[model samples]
Target: MTTPVEPPVPPADTAPPRPGRKLGPIADGVGSVHRAWLEPLRHTYLTSGLTLSDLSIRVPLAKSKISELLRGCGLYPRWEIMHSLSIQLQLPSWPLHRLWRQAAFEAQKSSEWVERSGDKAAVTTSLVPPLDHRAFRETVESDYSLYAQVFLDDDQRDTAVSNAFDILWLRWNEALASPDIRRFAWEALRATVMARTPHIDGRPEFGAAAFDTVALQHLTTETERMDQMAESLHLFKAMSWLPDRQLDVMVMRRLYGTSPEAVSDLLGLSLATVRSDERHANHFLQSVICPTPETEGKTA
Candidate 1:
């Protein structure tokens, strides 16, 4: 009780340009799978939908080649692979086109999330105002560091981090909260990342694929859920109660490990003032606002 992808014909207007150009087999609707094909193909056939029965007889490729190409493999054929399949099946092109677009969108997002993190410096730009520039860099850096440590070797770390990035970026809200901002970041990030890592697939380790996949999926899921529960902007306002200078002091000394002189130069404060401010911020966070959790079972 299922339907299959409809066949597609070349758009009517498709033609070779100019005199002596000669009519060409237009390739429109060639490479992409049509959306009408999604359910039946995915549910029943997977890559096996292109069976070379009498129905598949007229497709350009031989039965064996057709079978090989059914999954939409490594390289896209110069001709419309999907279009031929559609013709063989005698299905309409509309649904197949829709499915192809959907798959393209998903593949784009997946590439963005899993493939870009090998270059940690690429993520530093701020998209808008009211951004906690420090926290953003630190958080992304921490994620990168965690990934680097997870593998500990050059090839493993590089591949795993790249894959992890693509996996994370596809979820949208992990980087930007607003939908428009998310779209913009996703597009820009996708283009740049894909350019940088042309051959990345974002599958870190065969053994940990399931864990890594679920981890990133739920990481963003929880972030969105928690952002809602905590009321993001409201929480931001509440956190702003900490004086900017004290927050700066705590961040430099504790979070950054910057020396007092470096802190003084960065914050435009004197050495004495930097030391005093650090002491004050540390004392306040330790006692009033933030307390260190017990490290009994935690690493040093």
Candidate 2:
């Protein structure tokens, strides 16, 4: 009898449908960072030989609040509260902020994807697409302000995002080895910011003094480079004064050259809402530059 012949295998893409992919590092990293922060808080109490009650007294927080934080109740303290703890514990605020931001980002990303894609199981079960650094950055870059806005003011948020990318590049090798590369880069940056924060005297406060300083730096007949840098810095300081959401919307739409529809998608806003935000942001800036009588009257 002739040997039986088998049909050729189908292309891999034609294989039977599989269940959702594992989210892997996305879920794992978020939880790990949460624990990372909580454990240190608990350790501080332990190493100081203070009970939760005693710690509450020093932190000026309720014992229950301290307990909730220690237990990871999903509510992070405000920066002011963290700052207080940092002072008492001599721990840098940067690490806690960094970890907290990562945790928040991951949680929000998972929730938003589930909502948008209507794939609840995939997100909640940690069964989603295979994520890599480029995909992760693209996913998070749009609403990066969401995670960052929690810890940084509007002006600082853009700077922080830019800085994080730089940090990621500087530590590419180490970051590549991380179970969650994005989280690792962020935490590294947070540590760097915290470490350096103590050495820096102060940041440029948004005020007349800030503008005056910039003006003083301008040459009587500036080179093209100096003029460009001065203009850029002036605009940055001006933009910083806008409301948080407005600033975020403006930065993504203008600086990144993202389209309005794309901006809406990224920011989870309706098309109309995105346009309105941009309009309002621009109006606010224009009003500052050339005050309408109405605005001047309100100011007066």
Candidate 3:
């Protein structure tokens, strides 16, 4: 006779919400490290499709520790915490070790949390604050999986893609990993940062989020300008697929919004060459984007 495996479930009333309380040694370790400690943990339990109770039963760490970490505990992840977490996650020990080491390194580097305020966020703060615990877990795994796809070893990217869940993540992986793709991750991330700036701490306030009338209208106008700029980047990414001269024109115009004369001068091309390139780009976009039922069009 054998015992049937039980389904995982969230614990009821985990450890009375230990917020504002002083923590122990392991908790202290977690506090001193990167916010990404949960990245590995998320991959472990959340990605593996297990719940808190399931893991606590396997690992020695209390369910509360896991819950607290996910729910915004101030501690960074510890090796023992990771070991127990990986065991509960049922990952191979070797891969789990890599993840553990990577978590420690990444947490130390902590680039993602360099928000506009540039405040060194303690483990108590999140980089993207809009994310809830569940949402945050999904974002970390998804974003890092994209990073893995872009920068990871071939075997790593393939494995990550096989495990990834959505189009956003899929595109991100493709954007980051493919050498032919030209590192759009930095551009997109830069745009995201630019978009965030006006609404952020250092920039002049413009909107009702600032709770001002004319300020809000100015905010609206600035926001719309940013949206157009952001939308234009997607168009430029597509144009990069065209011939190099054409790509240059489109990038100068759309990506940076530079003038044709400016682009020609920069590339040492004649004005005619730049104009011709622009015309070629427009023709390609029209043929592909404005295709009719009678005509076949390629996806950008």
Highest-TM-score candidate: 2
Please tell me which predicted candidate would have the highest lDDT against the true structure.
Answer: 2
> Model 1 RMSD to the real structure?
21.6
The alpha-carbon deviation from the true structure for residue 4 of candidate 3, after best TM-score superposition, in angstroms, is 40
The sequence of per-residue lDDT tens digits that candidate 2 reaches over residues 1-300 is: 111222343343222332333112212232544555555555454444456555578886887676666666645444455556656765544545555545555455454432343221121222222345457567666456444542345665665665555344434444565444544554643443332222223432333322233344544654754665566565655566666567667766744557787666554455676788899988877676557988866533
Expressed as tens digits, the lDDT of each residue in 139-164 for candidate 3 is 33443333333223446444433333
lDDT of each: 0.38, 0.51, 0.42
TM-score of each: 0.23, 0.36, 0.28
Native-referenced Cα lDDT, model 3: 0.42
Candidate order by TM-score, highest to lowest? 2, 3, 1
lDDT of 1 at 269: 56
Per-prediction CA RMSD (Å)? 21.6, 19.2, 19.4
Candidate ranking (lDDT, best to worst): 2, 3, 1
Q: Where's the lowest-lDDT run of ten residues in candidate 1? A: 203-212
Model 2 clash pairs are 21-128
